[model samples]
Every structure is written in C-alpha cells, then in structure tokens.
Target: MAKCFPEPYDAVSESKAELLLYKALAEQLGPDYVILHSVAWISRPGGSGPREGETDILIAHPVRGLLALEVKGGRVSLDYRTRTWVSIDANGVAHDIKNPFDQARRGKFALLEKLKESPAWKKLGIGRFNIGYAVFVPNVGDGDRLRGPDAPAEMIGDRRDLSDLGAWVGQVLDYWSGQEGAGQQIGTRGVDALVALFARSVSTRPLLSARIADEEDVRFSLTIRQAAILDILRRQRRVVIAGGAGTGKTLIAREKAVRLASEGMRTLLLCYNRGLADHLREQCTTIGGLDVATFHQVCHRWIERVKAKNGRDLLSEARANLPRGDEFDHHMPMALANAVDTLGPIYDAIVVDEAQDFGDEFWLPVEMLLTRPDEAMLYVFLDENQDIYRRSAEIPVQGEPMVLDRNCRNTDAIHAAAYSHYRGAVVEPPQISGVEVNRLLASGIEKQAALIGTLVTKLVVEEGVAPHEIAILLCDPADRPARERALQTLPLPATVKLGRVEDFSRGGLTVDTVARFKGLERAVVILWAFDRCDVGKDRETLYVGMSRAKSLLYVVGSREACDHILAAQT
Candidate 1:
C-alpha cells in the first residue's frame, strides 16, 4: 500500500497517501475496526463546514471502539525547544507538515463522540468503549530524527509494517476498554456540547511546534574594506573617521551603529549640521527602533539629568550648559579638557558625523565621552576634502581608518572625470557605467549662464529629463547673481535657491554654491563661472561637484577657465 502511494507526497499526493494507508490498515484489522478518512473535528462551538477544523484519518474498532491515526510519508526532525517537526529534502531545505501528535489528540476526542452515536455500540450493550490514537511516518530517513519527548497516542515510525501497527492499535484499544467503566463517562451529547468540552481540553494541550531545517549554503565573512572599518570600531575606545570626499565615512558609521544596536548595545548617533543630522535620523528611523540623536541634543539631555557617578550640577544650569563658539578652536588638548568638564562620564557608544568640520576643541568633549577602553565607546565619520570652512589639523587618534572607494550612487563617466581631476588624491572610483562628462568654455559669467541655459534645455527637452534632476553649481559665492540672471532668461519655469524646501518639491532647477550642496546629488550637474585662479583650490571640490550627477555633467567657463578645468582632468 505504501509502495502504491506517490513519493515526496505534496498536496496532490496527500489524498492518495491517506487512501492507501487506510485501505492497508482496514485489510489487516478486519470489519470490527470502523475506518474514517479525512475526519475534520471542529473544536469551536458554533463553527461549521469542513474548513473549520483539520482533517487526517480516524479508525474505530468494535471491541476496542474508537481510534485515530494521522499518517505521513517522509523523514521528519523535531525541535524539542520550539516543538516543531520539519521535513527535509535532498538539499536540506525544510518541507511543511502538520504536527502529527496534535492531530492524533484532537481526532481521539472527536471520534469518541462519533462512536457513541453508532447503533452497533447499543446492540453490544457497551455503555462506553475505549479510544486510541497513533501517528505513522512511513518513510523515515537514516540521518533524520525526532526531538520532543514521547506522548500517549503518538507513534512515529515506518507505515510499511501494517501487521505490527495493527497489533499496537489493538493493545491501545484493550488498555482504554479496561478502564472504560472505571473512569467518568463521556456523556452522549450533541456536537455543540462535545465541541465545548474539546475547546476546554485543547487550551491545556500544546497547539503546534516551529522548526528550522539545517541548510547547506556556505556563509562568508565581510569584505576586506568592510572588515578594516569594523576592526577599527571594535578595537578603539575613541576614534575619528577622516577620508577624502565620496569615501562613504558616514555610511560606515551608520552601518556600525546598526550592527552594535542589533547586538543589544546602547548606541548614540551624532552629527554637527542639522541637514546631515536629519538625514541620519531618517535613515535610522527607517531601520526600525534605535536610539539616535544630534550631538547638541544629547549634551542638552545629559546636562538636564545627570545620573551617572561622575554627574555634575553645572550641566543642570542652562547658561553653563551652552556650547560656545570659541571652544571650537582653542587647541585639541585644551578643548578636550573643557569639553570633559562639561560632558564627563562618556556614553557606551558615540558615533559622530562630519568629523572634519569639527575643530581640535571638539576632541576635548570626545575624550571625556569614553567610559571604557576595552569596551570601545566612540566612532567618528569625516570627509577631509569637504572641509572648506576650517584650517584645523586632523585630530590624530587610534584605529586604522577604512576607506570605501565604491561610487555606488554615480555613473562611470562621472567617476572617471572625478578621478582624472583629483589625480594624486585618495579617490578610488568604483566600477560603473552610463554617464558623460563635458567641459564647455564660455566668454564670461554672462556667456557661461547663457550656455548653461542651453544645456539645461537640451537635458530637459531633448533628453526627457526632469527639471528637479538638474542642479547648477557656482564655485564662487558671488556667481549666484549670474546664475539667477540665467534662470530669469531661460524659457523654463524654475527658481534658484540655496537649498531645497517643501514648497520647491518638484519640477524646478536648483542653484547653489558648491559648498552648500556638498552632501546633495542630482541627475544633471552644471557648473557656472569657473575661473583660472580658482582651479587649484577647487580641484577636489570640483571632483565632488561633478560626481553628484547621475547621467550628465556640464562645466561652462571662460576659455582660460575651461582650459584649466580640462587640463586638471588630464
């Protein structure tokens, strides 16, 4: 009978296996055993229909009256902890199966009531008959095994030996029949009354178990670049991340924060600029629940509620708690001393963004934030090339800084141009494709603006790009006037602005200085009013500016200005 049933029994094969297993059992047990296939037992009082309950197989012998058997064909492994038995394939992925032990228990009670309704039981003059249950795993695997402790009416083994199974079923039936009159009688009641009793009993019994099958796929460690960064954060008590523009320092810091949080460690994410800090906060929020705040906010809160052993009353005072501008540049060690006085007894983990813009004075407060050396409490993210406002030396700290060269957000042409412009710098371009970089020479600011208008029109009308995708950058802060003049002359409806806002949501070109648009990116980037004198100082900045474009880059400047831009690329 087992041989006739399909191998690797799925939904289509389930009915076939049930029929085969029942026929074999009936042929061995004779007419005394009343066989019931696909018997659904709904434990809910008012529930109706076949869908209300789970169905398997049930058998009732006359002398050994009511019995239930749940059948399956395959290898099964039960996780004792989760109380789940998982079926596995050749590659070791889990196959789904209903819990046989649970099915048998439910079927036993349901069949007991069904047996009491029979006319044969009345003719036999039996007040109450015995009830039995069993589960058969037909094709057991050599390596597969069960995990949970054994239970009554739960039999898990091969189904091929029907004779031995029949004998076991008879024994179970005889045991229950002997104790029938001794115990309390299950009243001959309606389906509703029986269902109510079943519901109460089920609440005490375990429902279903969960399990995970062992997989064969090989797992690997992090890449060399990722490992280098993780190693630094893991080893150092306090360290700063400093690198060239587009090095992904902030991304590394964010990834570290997430990893530490997942490990149940308390971590704080800090950034200097509000825009960058807002961006970090949004990213953290998307990652679900995590503790993150800006540096100033953290300091304010700490000052408000000093609870640690080294807490000070000075932090509780509003005027004494404010961060002064002068404290930003009073040398590294002295700055550390002052900051330590203010924000002492450091956090468990501190992650700072835009570390380069922070002066030597910043490190003073940072040093005081380290609560332990071996526990590793501080991490900083910075881009050295983006430091256009400060002249402070890079704070020398422990930990080998990891460098990320992957230009994941830009095209190959943009990366190539960026690398060519900053030749000796540590800007390693990522492997990518699809973009064009062009250097257009104009007569002056007026002509540069005119050329930019033409390029924007071409990118929008001809290339089918959106206006919001275009960004016009000015190396000189004064070049904003020329950019605005160009916007006024263009036929397109758009506004020039220093940064984005809610009102300027979409379908408009934005114009800003290179420094102001440092962390932003666009689809098309146009640079206006470049001069020969600004070439060397703006080399790295220009690289960062051009790389912001996803598909196109247009640089409009005077002949000499254009020559300098083109020459720097070579």
Candidate 2:
C-alpha cells in the first residue's frame, strides 16, 4: 500500500487509462514508496534543455532512487512516414500528441536538476542517484509497435504489463541502472528532503485583516439553524425564540422583518438598544414597508400621534402622575398602549429583538400596535441570560418556544467568559477560535483605568487596529463619577476620541454602559469590570459586555475579581 501525494487520487488527464495505471502502481508498490500524481516542474534558466513540463507520475523509491512515468491513455500510434505520434479517442476523433517517451525523458532530467539544487539532497549524497524515465501505453497491446530508436521495448510498458506493474517497474529500473554511478540508495531522510523541497513548508501566521475577512464570510453565511427558524416563522403567526447570547436571535429577527415587509405588510423591527436600532434603521430605510426603532422611540412616536389626533398630552400627564424612577419607563409603554387603542393599529407585524431587557409593561403596547392583536404576526427573540435590565422577560403570547443555542458571534474565549454566569439552556460556542481572554489585574479603579489606557494605545498604534472598531463598556454606569474618570483618564491616541455608541461611524471609540451596548457588537472591546463582584445582579452585566466583542476582548479588573474568575474557570 504505497502512499500517494493526493490520497484518493482523481484523474486530471483527458482519458481514464492514466487512472487505471495509477491504481495499478499504487496497489503494486510497497509502503516504502511514494507516488506523486501529475508532478509539475519548471527548469531553471540555463539549467536544463526543456523550459517546463509535467510528469504524469513520479515515484520515489528508497532502493531504486527516482522514476518518472509518461502515460498515454487512448489508442496511440506513430506515423511512420512523418515520424509523428497520433492518438484516437473512443469518440472516433484523431489528434496529435507529444511523444510520451520524449516527455518522460524531459521530466526525468528536470527532476534530477531540481534535486541537485537542494542542500539536504547534496549533503545526503543521494543527489545524483539513478533517475529513470519510462513510457506506458495502457491502451496499446503490442509492445513491438512502440519499440523504436528512442522507445526501447524493455524500458516501456503496455496493456499486457498492467498486472504485476512492480515487476515491469523493476525491469525499467534495471535498464537505467546500467550506467556507472547510477544506482544509489535514497534513505528515509532523502525521501523527506525531496518532499520538503517540492511541497514547501508554510510556518507563518495569517494577517489580521485576512483572518477577519475569512471569519466574517463564514459567520454570515446562512446556516440551517437560521433557515429553520425562518421556516417556523412563516408557519406560525405568533412565536417566541429563546436562546443564549451569540445564538443569532437578532439576525433571525431582521430576516423575518424583511420578508414580512417585502410581502407588503407594514412591518416594524424593534429592539432595546438605541445604537442597534440606528444601525437597523440605516439598513432598512430604503425598504418601502419596513421601519426600525427602539422601544422608547416607538412609544414616543405614538404618544405624539395621539396628541396630534386628540388634544391629549399623554406624556406630560403621565409624567406628572408617575413616580420619579418610573416616570419614563412605565408611562411611555402605558401611554403608547392608550394612544394605539384610541388611534387604532399602525403596523401589520412586529418583530421584537433583545426582548429580555424590555420592560414587562412594554409588551402591551407592542401587541396593540399589531393590526390583529390575537391573530396578527408577533415574534419575540430573547436571551434569558442576557436580561441585563433585571426585568421579567415576559411576552403574553401563546404556545412553547423555539430555541437557537448554537452561538455564532463571539469568539470561543469570549463566549466562555460571558457564559460563565449564564443560567439557561446550554449554549454552544462560536466556531472560530481566538486568543485567550486578556485578564489584567490592577489594585483599584485608577490603576485599571491607566492599564486600559496603555492597552488602547497598543491596540491602536502598534497593532494597526482602527479606532472606530474599538469600544469601552462600563459595568457600573450608574456611578456617573467613575464613568467620567475612566474615559477622561485613559491615555488614548490624539486621533482617537470617545463618541456615543450609535454615532461613532466617522472615527472614535464607542463609550457606553454594558446594558446600553446590548444587541450590538465591536471587533475590539475593553470591559470596565474593575469593581466586578460575584453577585447575581452583576452576572448579566459582565456577560453582556464580554459577549459584545467578536474578535478581541480585554477584561480589566481588581486583583480579587480577577483571581475569582480565573480560579472558578480553572
């Protein structure tokens, strides 16, 4: 069982006779031999007679050195008068082909010249070992017809010699070994050197830009996991999609919205994150029937419409009556429901993304906006583990939920760090492998902030990363003083400045809270977890920030916090 260069060889030639001979040789040869199919070579300038040629099959034998075989597949013959070779295929078509004997000789000499330049071959003293050339006409039966001045009957093989090809090969090797200093042993080392010199070794990492492009292409390609979700959406009018982070819920929601809008259904794609809504708006603006907005944005629009239709200032009236903390959160959704009930339905279908973070009161307004409250289309995509807002992930819809647990956004390391606090259905990690999560330990917030500054400089200036692709997320954004100190104290490049998450496309790193940055992703993320405590409330906050990074992630925190994470993971 000889090992071929391309295992499970497929013929590249015009005829199948070469495949037949390849099988015969591969089966007849021993394990010590290597048969490379269709070995191509280019002669160095001022080195060999022929410029370039391809050897049908090159055999590397430890005992007999090297052998090149030129195989002519189909009915082959020679025109005696003009001394030219002719071939006729099974289609009754005649064509002229180069003499296989001449091809074999050129290929043999070219290979010999190639090995002579290899330092390993020269040092091993097997550079000038016996290199033989032979021709094989698999369709031809009579060897006498191929016998000529150049094509010796003993050196060539025909149809009768197909069986026991090893014996015929030995006969060819013996004929070439007659010349002085022709038969030399090529040990295992020589064969290794030959393979190495021909098939060059690659020992370098890929470019970051190339790696990013490749991963993006693979990541975005529609998988059966997503298609099945869409198929379910088409069948069911009301559905709930439950999954963990990176399960592609947002993608599924967007696709559903586009299909509904294309069918001329007034469609609304709604999400919790303002930045994500802005991004979706830009994408869906050209669409005639589609509209994208945040939950609050939709609430405000309907509230204003109610005021215009009827002389009712719902927002001001509700603002005065509602509590200080619940002023905007509770009233907007309540007011939106009142406005929609009075003003009637505004959309045929509504697809809600990041439903885990939306207030429980928001679902009433969402359902009321649909043309048919009970019969119309309503799809909710949520990740229970990503409920960073501490709200009850409630949707007053019917039936069981469909889950997408195969994570496809963040890298493997990022997924692990984020899912550490996850408490739901098991989530599969991203297919792409990445560097380990960077864990930097500092004593306090000031030290961690300074370390973040140094990391920003390195990632931007030294690593050639675009500033806009970077983001800094805070776990404790309610602490206004800490947020300001972290962003101002960082020693970032002069060209790189801080901007809001939604409006940083021009040039700037996005600075936002982890909860606000949900449903959005960045190529690079620096999570501000300096004061991260092992509490249930802090669980999803850090997970949201960790999962937001697609390519790179840096976790800067206190020494105690860092030790806790590392030990727990270990």
Candidate 3:
C-alpha cells in the first residue's frame, strides 16, 4: 500500500471526491508511491486576503514524479457559453463551480514553486522531472466524452478508470511525457527528498487539544452513520431520546434546535447545567429564533417578563408562602406556569437535554409554553445513567423512545472505567485506543491535592499543555471547598490558572464537582475519587466525572480505591 500523510485520513474532509480518490490511491498504489491529501499552503502572505492554493491529492512516484490530482464528485456538467462547471448536489440543486482542470493546473504550479524552496530540490536538480496536472471525476465516466479545449481526454481519470488506476496512471504519464521538460525522471533519491521536505513542516507533539480533535473526528464518522435519524425526527411531533453518555444526545439536540429555528420557528433549547447552557448560548448567538438556556433560566425569564409587564413579581409572592427548600421545588416552576398561562404559548418548539434532571413540575410549564401544545415539536434527550440529581423526570412526551447505543466520546480505556458502574442498556465503547486509565494512589486529602497540583504544573510548564485544557473534578461537591483550599496551598506558579468552568477559559485549570461539570469536557481531568465510595449513589457520580475527560484521565484516591479500579480493569 502507498504511504499516506497523517496515516489515517481526516474523517471530516469537505470533498467526498477527494476522500474516495485518497483511499483508492492508498490501497491500490504500490509501496513506492506517497499520497498526500489536502496539501494546503498560503502562497502570498501579503496578498489582499491571503491566497490559498490546495491540491486535493498529491501523488509522488519515484519514476513518474509528482501528479497534482483535482477530484470532482457529484453530477458534473459544463456551461458552454459562460465556461463554468455545474455541480448537481444530492438535493437536485445545481450550483456553478470553478473548472476542475484549471484548478488542477494552478495547484500543480503552486506546489512546484513551494517544493523548489526545499534545499533538497536544488541539490538534487529533480525540478526538471515531469510535474503534471490531472482532473479525476469519480462521478463521471468515459474520459473521451469529457475532453474539451483545456481538458485533454488522456489527462482526465473518469469513473471507469478507477477500477484500473495503475493503467490510468500509465496513460496520464504517457501524455505528460510529450510536454516541455518532461521525463527527466524523479528517481528514488528524488522521491526521498520530496518526502523529507514535507515531513519538516509537521513534526511536533500530539497535544491534548489535538487528541480531543481526533476523538471528535471519530465521533463525526459515527454521527454521520446516525444522520438517517434526522428524517425520523422531522416526521415525529414529540420524541424522547434515551441513551448513555457519549451517545451524542447533546450534539443531536443542538442540530435539532438550529434546524427548527432556521425554519423560522421560535425554539427554546433547555438543559440542566449552567455551563452547558452558556456553551449552547454561545453556539447559537447568531441564530435569531433560538433561545437556549437552563431550566432555571426559563423560569427566571418568564417570571421576570410577567413582573416587567404588570409591575408585580409573581415569584416573590410565591416565595413568601413557600418554605426555604420549596422555593425552587414548588414556587419557581409554579410561578413560571402561571406566567406562561398569562402570556399564552410563546415558543413554537422546545428541546431539552439532561431531561433526566427535570422534575414533573418542570414539565408543566414547558408543555404550556409551546404555541401548539398538541402539535408543536418537542425533543427530550436523556441519559438515565447520569441521574445524579434524582428527579421524577416524568417527561410529558409520547413515543416508543429512540435509543442511541454507541458511546462515541470517551476512549476504550475511559469507557471501560466508567461503564463498570453503569447499569443500563449496552453502550458500545469508542474504537480509538487512547492512553490507559491511570489510578494514582494517595492516602489523605492533602496528598491527593499535592499529586494533582504537581501533575497540573508538569502538564502546563513542562509538557506545554494549555492550562485551560485541564480540569480537576471532585467526586463530592461538598468536599469542593476543602479540595480548593488544599490545591491552593502549594506554591505553584501564577501561570497555572484555576477557577470554575465559567472562568475556565481565563484560567487553564478549573475546579468543580462532578455534578456541576456534567455535560462538559476538558482535555485532562484529575478526578478526586478519594474515600467518597458509597457503592450506591456515588456510582452515578463517578460515572459522570470519569467520562468528562476526553483525552487524559487520572483518578487520585486511597490505596483501597485504586486497588478496586485495578481489579476491575484486570
């Protein structure tokens, strides 16, 4: 097989044409060939808006030299009058695209100029070798029919040519051999020079941020497999999605909200956590019809709206009659229901995440706030495994709930550690083989804090990991204050920033409990599982905390706790 750049191709490449050509080139070509996908460069830094030239696929063969291939996938046709290429998308939408042959020619020249800057190119004098350009249209067949004034039949690879790529390459080489300065021959030494020159631009450590991106790449592939469900959601009036963590519930909810709002519906996206709500709000800021907030935010907004209109705060009157704990439990949601009743239905649709935390009282006003109670779209995403808050969660929706089975967020190691305590339907672990789950033993609270602090310092100062990428989660929120005090005791550098998730981007390190940090992820997570083992409720808390780490995970606890984890892994 041919050696490919990045070893595994990026899952989210925009051009399906290029991905198809990349796989074919990698599998069918001999070991001597090197294929690079999406070879991009900024040609002129001082240009008006920075000129970028990207070759879809650059194939290097020792004897054939470099071939710049531009691929066009969908139904391709040409406008005779304007000289523009037309692409018919899956939706039967026709859009004008640039001529593929012209693109290949430009990319070929730009790459040649860039490659000449390498010291090896001048020393070996391989610049005189055949440097060719070709257009590969995987969707269109019969290369002879594709011939035009600028596009020669022999220089184009069509659908039929894909079956025998080697034969097609030979034909292309033969055609290019007749060109100027053709076939001086790029020998083994010349190919080595090209590969060596390309390697220098990409030599660096795979940081935590990069690994998290790799996880997202795998998640994206899995998410694509789930795209069929979007049609089902569109047809249904109400849906309650049931899944375990990493099954892409939050991702689906975000997409659903965006789609509904884009269609001019007044949509409300609700979640349990404030941090998650803030993140959603940030994502949908430019989206006009989408109102994303927490359950509490919905109550506060409605209650305040009523007060602003009538100059009477219904919530304050309700709070006077309710007990201390009953304020949020009964007073707030009831006031919201009353406020909704007065204002009538304002939202056309409502989507909820972490629905497992929403109580029966919470659902009363949610359904009432929808413009058409019977027909309005309602989506509820829930993972019962993460019911740490333990509410009634009697979501007022009707359906034979859709189940998401794959856990696409955490790696195999993090997945194994978390799912051990979970008691639910099977959720398949991620396929990526990430770093091993580390169980570091520390007897006391002080020792645990010291271990985490030292590790954080090493990650930030020594290893060059950004401070904002690390999060320290406490198993028990009650122990959060003591842990924070302990972590601050160490004489660490001022660069190591530690705060809550709201200030997380400000400080590289965030300190929060597992409950608050739910529905969020960081690159590195130091979980303080020390002596908080209750075997009952703590299992759910442990599951949520451990899974929050997307890349690197470390559990600091007592020797017994460490031993328990070790035994489970074995």
Clashing pairs in 1: 83-209, 336-364, 346-369
Compared with the true structure, the alpha-carbon lDDT of candidate 3 equals 0.76
lDDT of 2 by residue, 1-570 (tens): 887765536435565877888888889988888887766643332322223456888888777777899988778889756889888888868889988888898888777766664445667875457778888888888856778888778877889998888888887887888753565678788787776554322221111222122233333544457655775465477789988877778777877787666544678999988878877776566777889999999888988888888989988777776756485578888788888888998687799998888887888888889766766678888888887677874687778889897887788988888888788888888888999888777877778778878888898899977777788888776664776566686767887878767556545778888877887777898877537455466787777778888889887787677656545445
Model 1 lDDT, residue 563, Cα: 65
Q: lDDT: which candidate is best?
A: 3
Better of 2 and 3 by TM-score: 3
Worst 10 residues of 3 by lDDT: 202-211
> Which ranking of candidates, highest TM-score first?
3, 2, 1
Q: Model 3: residues >4 Å from true position, as ranges? A: 1-222, 320-325, 565-570
Q: Taking the tens digit of each residue's C-alpha lDDT, what string does model 3 give over 284-318?
A: 78887899999988899889999999887878777
TM-score of 2: 0.60
* Candidate 1 structure lDDT: 0.54
Model 1 regions lying over 4 Å from their true place: 1-224, 227-244, 286-346, 370-374, 394-396, 421-427, 479-482, 485-489, 494-504
Q: Candidate 2, which segments miss by more than 4 Å at Cα?
A: 1-219, 319-325, 478-480
Q: Alpha-carbon error at 393 in model 3, in Å?
A: 1.8
How many clashes (backbone N, Cα, C below 3 Å) per candidate?
Answer: 3, 0, 2
Which 10-residue window in model 2 sums to the lowest lDDT? 202-211
